[model samples]
Target: MSDSKAARARPIIVFDFDGVIADSHDVCAAACRWAAAELGHSDMPEKPFAELEAVTYEALAATISVDPERFAGLVCGALEARTTCAPIFFGVADIMMELSRDFDIAILSASDSDLINDFLITHGIWHLVKCVMGRDVPGSKTEKLLALKSAHDGKFVAMIGDGVSDVAAALHADVRAVGVAWGWQSARRLRASGADAIAMVPADLLDLIVVQELTEAPTR
Candidate 1:
């Protein structure tokens, strides 16, 4: 890229949903089990998450002679609420508060858009975020981040998440890559990606995000 083009791609942050935003594994797993139970899938294990990865609402309902459509709606309704109701990782609130002072903050998540928005809105951080990188309402994660770059004027952009897909975006998006450990993937997995930086905790993120705007409130 030319120096002139490089100047336009600024440093900004993107986040992952689920584990990064809130510890939603339990909530999501429980919701799935509850939905399965409602469908009379007696075969479902008592474990909240053991079968969650394999059991979609449609599949569970089919197994129990229930209407998939109706059960899906029920699952969505119940789980969406849980999106905003989970526990925030320790020190995340403080780190977000501090980081917001410097960097251009945004949500670049692989999770569903409504889920991400709900989590942010419930926690009152929705207003703090200027943009969101949600997976396809009708598009992919790559599309969302590209759009985010198009909308900003910063010289650097960052893909911050706990997955390989996020690494792909960092490569495809032509920006620096970052990994966070408070999410689904392991730190070992992230480090293996050869990312630019790996944040073991949200508080560690402060060191990378703060540039020269410590005293200046980030552009809202």
Candidate 2:
């Protein structure tokens, strides 16, 4: 294929690192609990994973009457340690490798950039990604998506995540939003959050991407 054609054929996929790629739900919950206690919010009621995943880190901290920045630090520290032990979900590496062959993969996550990078490197898939916009990054995921859209003008973009914020960002950026059921939010919650589609498993995600590529392919 010609260079232009090849570029046109490839889609840009942005992923949320935590719940989408890594099975970090428990790690996140533990971190939240720790932060709550350490920050003197131990009396705060425990929230369901779906509810927690739906809110921004700042909002979650605010709900528990804790300082967002300090809570974020605690969570980040705990998450980094947990991920160092075991990060990537089962079969994620293989699927990421396959997707990288036909897509320009990127990461837009609320997790710390260093932690995300460490997890990706540990799993040997860091090289597969083209960009990573983390919480430490300068802007929100919506802003990051807009910048990516401007850079990759006319190319199809999609965001795969397990959070309501991901879907909201995708909507704000006018891109495809795909939710994963195996992550932090349940499929029902993801659906209610306005995700375009939900993948029940890793293979299902691959199939969803294929279908989206075909559906969005430009007419000759």
Candidate 3:
């Protein structure tokens, strides 16, 4: 096989769904509010989206005083209902398609797999993705990352996400954690999370991957 073929056969770029791919904060926040109200916390004060986006998904559920597992189910159902309507960030499809040429793309999201799969399919970008590992998978992101690493063997795995949890999970799984500036969290927040690198925009992400090639040693 040529060098390009070998490169394409290895190295996976994983993405987080809601914030990273789909701009679904409002929808997710609405779901959270509805679930909180269902649990009799309707009076919960609203926080700024930026404030809410700063934290991890688990922390968000706890802040709303909803049982985590129940909140997850409620949010999943809400997202499923909104799957066809939620919009991904502009130019993301182009970037994904470009990267798909040299690297296998995958999603390692906190959202439900079926919902994400449907969303990708609805947007006509499902073929660019190699796999979807969502909350339905029986483990944390760290465990899922580990599974991906093991499954791909010698492939270099990189997790691209918008939250600190993603950085932590990727590092824990012994993979590279790349942050996106256009997602739920700010670039500063991602930097603080010890991300291997941060992409300022969808286009910058493509440059980062193709130019840097993510060949440096991963942070311990």
Candidate 4:
């Protein structure tokens, strides 16, 4: 066996706030729905999430307009409202505490930082994390990961999210990626997107990140 500290330092877990930690699929879709209604689209195509995921807010907005900034403020309002309307997945707080005992937890999501902070405060679990990063940071989520890698002195980083953008960030930073079913993207789509692993429940996430369960995890 190794030093307890050494075992805890394998990978820094960067979790995306929206889909993975909370039911933000609908929170974000509410924004898109508002955007669609504004443009008079018959319906929001991303509602089903049916395997094809719209990753970035900026990218998804283009489907409705050439000038997305014009609608940014409006959609932000709806997303802010919807994020609080739903319940977060079960065991999120409990598992987050367990995960924090070993891994350094950071929040990196496409969500607006203000909203993420609000949700965290509302949930009373915000203080458990090491850092909170959002898309608004310089160069966005991908850039934030690069910065995190640089800061960690080249430790293996694990990016946890429920969207393709999260996967892209993990790949760009040369980190492992885990997608959770608790989020918006369907389980099938997450696998197709090349996630290293996908957890069916918040408790299942414990198997992958912590060394305590390494020998106990089911072999493929």
Score residue 53 of candidate 2 by CA lDDT.
49
TM-score winner: 3
Which residue pairs show backbone clashes in model 1? 9-154, 9-155, 9-156, 10-154, 10-155, 10-156, 11-156, 107-133, 136-139
Candidate 2 lDDT, tens digit per residue, 99-216?
A: 8887788898887888778888877888999888888889878899888765665365578888888888888888888888888777888899888888898888778887556335
CA-lDDT, candidates in order: 0.64, 0.77, 0.78, 0.70
Which portions of model 4 miss their true places by more than 4 Å? 1-11, 46-54, 81-86, 212-220
Between candidates 1 and 3, the lDDT winner = 3
Q: Would you list the rank order by lDDT, best first?
A: 3, 2, 4, 1
Q: On residues 5-121, what C-alpha lDDT tens digit does candidate 3 reach at each position?
A: 554466778888878899887887788788777777775444323445334445667776668778667767776776256898998999999998877888988777888888888
Against the true structure, candidate 4 reaches a TM-score of 0.82
- What candidate 2 gets wrong by more than 4 Å, as runs, is 1-10, 44-48, 81-83, 212-220
lDDT of 4 by residue, 77-174 (tens): 67766534445677888989887776677898766787877788888888877788765565766678877765655564478888776776677666
The residue pairs found clashing in candidate 3 are none
Q: List the residue pairs that clash in candidate 2.
A: none
